[model samples]
Target chain A: MEWRAAVRVTLKPGVLDPQGKAVQGALHAQGFRTVSEVRVGKYIQLALTAESRREAEEAVERMCRALLANPVLEQFAIRVWPAEQGEEETP
Target chain B: MEWRAAVRVTLKPGVLDPQGKAVQGALHAQGFRTVSEVRVGKYIQLALTAESRREAEEAVERMCRALLANPVLEQFAIRVWPAEQGEEETP
Candidate 1:
């Protein structure tokens, strides 16, 4: 079966996120006055063949640890499910 | 009240994503031969003050339109919820 996966990689706590801080400042300057903080991360979507949901999840987790995310500075959450016909349009 | 929001930005269908293709090739080379495709996107986390969930959602949508995402080549989904005590640690 083909499975679709999404991995969200975010900076760990206490990490200095200059990109996030710069975005926050930009938002404030643009009149989003209530925005207090912003954090930026990466979202990766994958399509793969797997025998089962569990297998897909494990593969995705391994991908995260190996290449999708940097464990020292980042943490990742993964979501996996069977792929739908038109799901590829949106990722 | 303080609200937490996540914005997921993905490439629009039919858009050329060399980065995605590169990652897919890398993954396949690493022995993940079953992998068919990959897509890359951005995930943004925000902390802000809002009167209600609706307000928070609106602000986030506006942010996506104005700065966080490029509508011509990308689409974005927004998730808003109340801020939890330690939620910032992961985003």
Candidate 2:
């Protein structure tokens, strides 16, 4: 089954994302005032075909382990979607 | 309307993700030998109610600009989904 995988990797909240905080300050400088928060993170879009949901999760976990994420300071969430649905669905 | 948002930011390739590379090496050292890539990042699950899809995106973009990402080194994408769809849709 060809699926869409969204892999999010972010720094642990208490770890101090100065980069994120700095960007937050910059946005305030830019005048986009409605911004309530600014925490920087990574999103990986993968193109894969799996036989089952389990297989896809395992594949994404593998990708995270190899090229998609770091486990020590960051955490991730994996959602597998069937290729048929567009942005209208949520996991 | 309540919706879901996914944010992704990655270090520019070749910018030296030593942290990510180190974790990749560690995964290799472990027994999960099939992992092909592991890069490390953040996932923020937001529960927001918006008037429209555009509003939701603007909200997340605001979040990214201020606290979620560093414009100097990162980028992001926003997708909005209705609360009715479960985890089976693709964006």
Candidate 3:
């Protein structure tokens, strides 16, 4: 079966996020005074072939640990679903 | 009232994604043979002061258009909810 997964990788709490701080400054300069804080993270979408959803999820978890995320400074979350006809296409 | 918003920014379907291709190559080289495709995007979390959820959503939409996302090359989605006691803190 073909599966699609979405991974969200965020910095662990207490880690310094200079990119987030820079974005926050840019927002403030644009006159968005209501914005109090900003943090930036990564969103990754993957398409894979697996026997079942459980297997797909487990593979993605390993992928996260091996390369997708930095265990010491980042945490990740994953969501999986069966791929639709056109959803798996690279274009 | 304080609100928290999450924004996901992705490249438009036809946009070139060298980053995604590089990651996919890295994954395949790492022996994750089942993987077929990968796309990378951005996730942004914001803490802001707003009178209501609707207001917060609107403000975030505006933020995405004005700064967070490039309209010509990317698309974005937003979700907003009331801020929890500790969620609004910058640290």
Candidate 4:
């Protein structure tokens, strides 16, 4: 089966997000408030084919650690579309 | 209501991901294959509160354009949780 997944990688909180800071400043200058926090990172959607969910999850995790993310500077998580049958998806 | 959302920002396909390339090179040297591609970027998860779904989407979109994304170099999409109670979520 082929599935679509979205992956996100971000620097840990308190880590310097110079780029994010710069963008935050820009927004503040424009009079936008209610944005109590700002962090920047990449978003990716991939189409994958696998025989089992376990196998698919493993591949995505490796991809994140291997190249999609920089553990030395960031942390990441992957969200497979169509929530798993029994997962709690808080809204 | 407050909800958890994830944001991803990535260079569009074919745009140069120099950092991704460097990491890709390193991974290959380490003998990991099956990774046909690697694109590096940041990922973010947020906790948000809003009066309506429209308000939430607007806030997230503004955040993306204002600080989370570099329009000159990348594109992004917002995925709200619980799939709007009836949205399609392909797993």
Candidate 5:
């Protein structure tokens, strides 16, 4: 079966995030005064073939640990679902 | 009311994504051969004050238009909800 996984990698608590601070400043300058803070991170989408949903989740978790996220400074969350028909699959 | 917004900004179809391609190659090299493709994008979280949910949605949409996304090459999706208690709020 074909599966789609969405991985969100975010900075752990107390980690300094200069990019997020910069974005907050920009928003405030643009008159978005109510915006108190901003945090920036990565969203990764993966397409792969797996035998079942359980198998897919396991693979995605392994991938996240191995390459998608830094265990010390970042945390990752994963969501997986069966791929839908008509979704683009690049060759 | 306090609100939190999650913004996902992704490349539109057919926009060249070299980063995605590189990650895909790296995954294959690591021997997880079932991986077919990958797409990388930005995930941004915002903590803000709004009068109501409707107001928060409108503000987030405007933010997307003004800076969060490049409409020519990317598309953005926004999810907003009330801030949960105990969530980190940087002073």
Candidate 6:
């Protein structure tokens, strides 16, 4: 089966996120007064073949641990679904 | 009311993503043969106060257009929900 996964890689809390802070400052300058906080991270989308949903999950987990995310500075979360469902290809 | 929004900012299709390519090359070097392709983008989490869900949606959309994403090279998608759901705070 073909599977698609969306992985969100975020800085572990207490880690200084200068990029996020810069973005927050930009928003505030633009008059987004209601926005209290902004944290930025990486979003990765993968398309691959898998035997089943469980297999896909395991593959994504391995990918996250090995390459997709930095375990020391970042943590990742994965969402997996059938590729044919058509959600992965969107911009 | 408080609302949380998650924004995904991705390169428009056909845009060259050198960072994604680097990550993909690293993954292939790691022997993850099943992984066919990888695309990387920005993920942003926002915590803010809003009068209602509709208001929060509008605010997030405006933020996306004005600062959260680069409209020329990127597109953004926003997912909004009540702040108390507690799903937004995970690592």
TM-score of every model?
0.93, 0.53, 0.92, 0.61, 0.92, 0.92
List, residue by residue over B7-89, the lDDT tens digit for candidate 6: 98999889998888888888889988888878899999889999999999899999999988899999988888898896564
Minimal lDDT window, size 10, model 6 chain B: B82-91
- The per-residue C-alpha lDDT of model 6 at residue B1 equals 95
* Candidate 4 ranges with C-alpha deviation above 4 Å: A1-7, A11-25, A41-74, A79-91, B1-4, B47-49, B81-91
Residue A73 accuracy (lDDT) in model 6 = 98
TM-score, candidate 1, is 0.93
Task: For candidate 4, write residues B1-91 as lDDT tens digits.
Answer: 6544556667866798887667657656765453345566655555556776678778878878876778889876676663344322321
What DockQ would candidate 4 receive versus the native complex? 0.20
A90 in model 4: Cα distance from truth in Å? 16
lDDT ranking of the models: 1, 3, 6, 5, 4, 2
CA displacement after TM-score superposition, residue B12 of candidate 4 (Å): 1.8
The CA lDDT at B7 in model 2 is: 58
Better of 1 and 5 by lDDT: 1
On residues A1-91, what C-alpha lDDT tens digit does candidate 2 reach at each position?
A: 6665666666665766776666656656777454445556665544456788789788778767665556777766677676567432322
Q: Candidate 6 at residue A89, lDDT?
A: 40
Q: Please give the TM-score that candidate 6 achieves against the real structure.
A: 0.92
What is the fnat score of candidate 4?
0.23
Off by over 4 Å in 6: A88-91, B89-91
Order of candidate numbers by DockQ, starting with the best: 6, 1, 3, 5, 4, 2
What TM-score would chain A of each candidate receive against the reference chain A? 0.91, 0.81, 0.91, 0.81, 0.90, 0.91
Kindly report which residue stretches of model 2 are placed more than 4 angstroms away from their true locations once superposed.
Answer: A33-36, A86-91, B1-91
For A1-91, candidate 1 gives per-residue lDDT tens digits of 9898888899988999999999999998899989999999998989999999999999988988888899999999887878875463322
Best by DockQ: 6
